[model samples]
Target: MEAYVTIVAVAPFFLRLLKLLTIVLTSALLALPVYAASSPEQTLGLIRHTFRSHRPPPPFVRYTLTRRQLTNEGFPDFIWTYTYHIWCRTSDNAALGRRVFRGGSYGSLEFLRPTFNAATDPGPPTADLFEPAPATKQATPAPIFDRLREIGGVEALGETDYQVLSAVTEGELIHVRLLPRREPERNRLRELFADRRTYELKKAVATDRLFTQFQSYPELYTLTLGAAGGYPVVTAIHGVVDDSTFDEAARYIDYTFTEISFPATMPDWYFEPSGYGAHAKEAPQ
Candidate 1:
């Protein structure tokens, strides 16, 4: 086994194929929009075509949790929402969707991309947004800070036990890469993965903006949601190919087949009753 391992390691090129595919895919995504979609049915059909077609075997789907948000509910305020943007790829297409789910009892989907974090922080801030903190105050925040603080500050993600990646954004929209602490030989490769995820999310947002403004859908396109629980709490749009013309864009990355399955967590507010007196109330003395 050791000899075989050594032989494989010494092979002229071990990651050549993976590197090539990644380069090709990344270039394709960058050149065009992440993907374009007309509707859920239309989008799923395209995935089927892309993967089941003959050009190349379908690759495994990959997902990245770009951002999350939450919101408050009625009396007792037991509910909390969560929205997530998960990205994946098909043989010749990028597949994406959004889902919104509620938390707590008697909740319901308020809108697509369940309001994960409260629209605004209701609690007091550990520190001010822009101004510098007083010298006497501690630099770090308390155990629980508002969503803005969490989003504004650097966030480190982990895989199992080890820290895999970290991300920070300059503008609320654009994703910025931070230096990695680990200095593995394959550090660059890992960074590329992070970059790709960020690019996908960014392009998804751009595609949605175009759809709303231009009313034009690219040939190779997909749309997915970021869900708080089960529904499209937040939706993302992507166009795999969008060159000068539709035909040109279709050439590089075109897919006709795909399928995806994901678990949907029930939103906390779904079962919650609405109105001030929806539930039985004690009579005032």
Candidate 2:
């Protein structure tokens, strides 16, 4: 009878000990990796890997683009819609065909005619009737990935020109902030947010400042991407060029892409200006 009483008294204590041991083991199992929280280089390496491993879409891609500019008071000042055909091998050579322009000085029915350019040509011809031959040199719009790769100093993200400031996990995304290491970079800051599971860039923001004539002008650019047909595609781009120093309000532009597609086959002449047939015309002046 005395031995039985001792056994009953110690049973509760043994059960409590077992519960405490289980709790400790469970906490250890759920702990995050030490390097993930403390090492910024590792995070950068992962991001670079993800970018390098990304498979670009097929050679041919076509989409519709809608661009709108908003005034300082948030009113639409200009609107443009166009069908874009691009050869993915070289995105710099794209055709903005069947364009429609509205707002600003353009009347409701003032639509710019369709235009196309040859792959070997520098750019489209002048839309103005009185303009000279061989259009003047102008900046051309580029794909988001191309722009990012250029700004980040080629395919490597942590090159000498770029400095990774910090990286941290926030909910379902990994946020990385970077800065330009050289004075000539003109970039003030760059931030990238990627999906935690896939490490694909979901959004990116960059700021740049340019000095001209003893004055400084700041510009901000943002890009957002969405997954389409198992590939990450740029969905929207917004930019603002601050002109407050000249007593002019900031100019805001928003460009959105829709109906993105990657066709299996594209004719050789599709990229040539002559292939546009009767629709081929000069670019807007």
Candidate 3:
């Protein structure tokens, strides 16, 4: 009986020691810092450097724009999200342009377009033609760029002033910027692009699983410029789904960024200080 009693007392002490050792081992494993994972900024910097390193001769310049989705959380009813972004270009032949990164967020389950409030005369016939009307003094038509200009930080670049810079990689995106007007006229044009395609996230499961937990998916587009100051710009459009997964999002992002184009005639609707496709034809340097 004494021997059994002693064994029972020792067992508790041994178990305590085992638990102590286990905790020490776990801490040691965690303490060894894993290889420094590249930050989004570092990844972006590497892309700019890589583009310059490969081009012929010294004194060459490059530029890159990174748009990323910073926050994406899936909820039972909806997905809440936001993006932070940055743009960097070469300043001199060898000097890299300082990166300008900004962060912002947006919510979209159902977005409503702001009502058009006409303020003044529609003005002379513009790029998109309008028919003549009787001169009755109603409020004039709002300037085409009015709404766009309202959003801050739009820079106007003159045509021929900037050229295509370089082609950046797919991984540089870490921040995202919300482009004004979620439903633009360009969306209609996108429907016509022969290259444009859609993917259906179809999963065949056992009949028991009828409750399809849906999450929103993003569509990506990458535009690479051919000239000196030009850089790649990524755009994404997203919607909710009843049966989609993160893997589907990865595929959509890959395909979308791979194919987009610059229009032949710059639309006034996308003019500078408001739109992403800046450097319109009218503005002079």
Candidate 4:
């Protein structure tokens, strides 16, 4: 009888020990980097692939962005949602947005057309249309740049600006952590994440001055891409936004691309804006 009781007690202790060991082992595996062979070529290649733009990426996309403005008390106070149509190019990007609501608190916001592309617009402006190419080197548009930053398009950052701190495979996706080579780059772009096989950018997080150029603030960006028309188009974005022109408190924003399409044709006001391709009505058609 005494041996039976002792056996039961010892069995429970062993089971508890086994459970503790399992947790530790699982955590250790997560902490360690998965290696295939002598070199990490696969991981390195994936990083480089996502940094650069590839062919077949759609030039136009339309998405609904939801901004949940949070208070210092950790409560979502103001929620702003808008549907935006953006045309992206190497040198130009344009977007037009209208207010949408989840509950009923839609505020007054006029979205200017997006015209800055982080992948290339960070450099000097393109040549003038009416004048000679060298005669006019136009200044970079500040608002366009802000739109790019707000939307989590930080791929324009050069490779030399950052170093791959660590990379781990989580299921089929590759999660990479990056650090700035210099302290200055941190103020511009702090982090980036991308996919390997399709060469689609996943996330671009940064802390930089934007919009009205007040001061730099933290931004966490999550991005998603989908295949459309046999090409890649940004499907979604989850981010935190706060800058000089924005609310005092940081806001959690989500950009969901409901429709991704290219303009079949242009209209009479084709020469109105430099980056805009089609009007709001003609975009989805």
What TM-score would candidate 1 get against the native? 0.17
- Give each model's clash number: 68, 0, 20, 4
Cα distance off (Å), candidate 4, residue 150: 32
Sorted by lDDT, highest first, which candidate order results? 2, 4, 1, 3
For residues 1-285, could you state the per-residue lDDT of candidate 4 as single tens digits?
999999998999999999999999998876544433222334544444433334423434444443344555556656333433333232333334445554644333233343212211111111111011111233433123121111255433234445666666555455666665665423244444545344344554444222323444445545555555654445555666554444545455554665555554434233235434445444321
What TM-score, over all chains together, does every model reach?
0.17, 0.57, 0.18, 0.49
Query: In candidate 1, residue 69 scores what lDDT?
Result: 21
Stronger candidate by TM-score (1 vs 3):
3
Q: Give the TM-score of candidate 3.
A: 0.18
Q: Point to the candidate with the largest TM-score.
A: 2
Candidate 2 collision pairs:
none
Q: Model-by-model lDDT, in order?
A: 0.27, 0.51, 0.24, 0.42
RMSD of each: 24.2, 10.4, 23.3, 12.5
Tens-place lDDT per residue, model 1, 1-285, is 999999888674757877888999987776542344333322322322222222221232223222222222222212322332322222212223233244523322221211111122110101111111122322222222222212346421222211323333234332322232343211211111112222322221111111213454332323332322221211332334344543432323211111222323322222222422332242110
C-alpha root-mean-square deviation, candidate 1: 24.2
List candidate 4 segments past 4 Å from native: 1-42, 50-53, 56-66, 71-80, 85-91, 96-159, 183-216, 241-251, 268-285
Better of 1 and 2 by lDDT: 2
Error of 1 at 41 (Å): 21
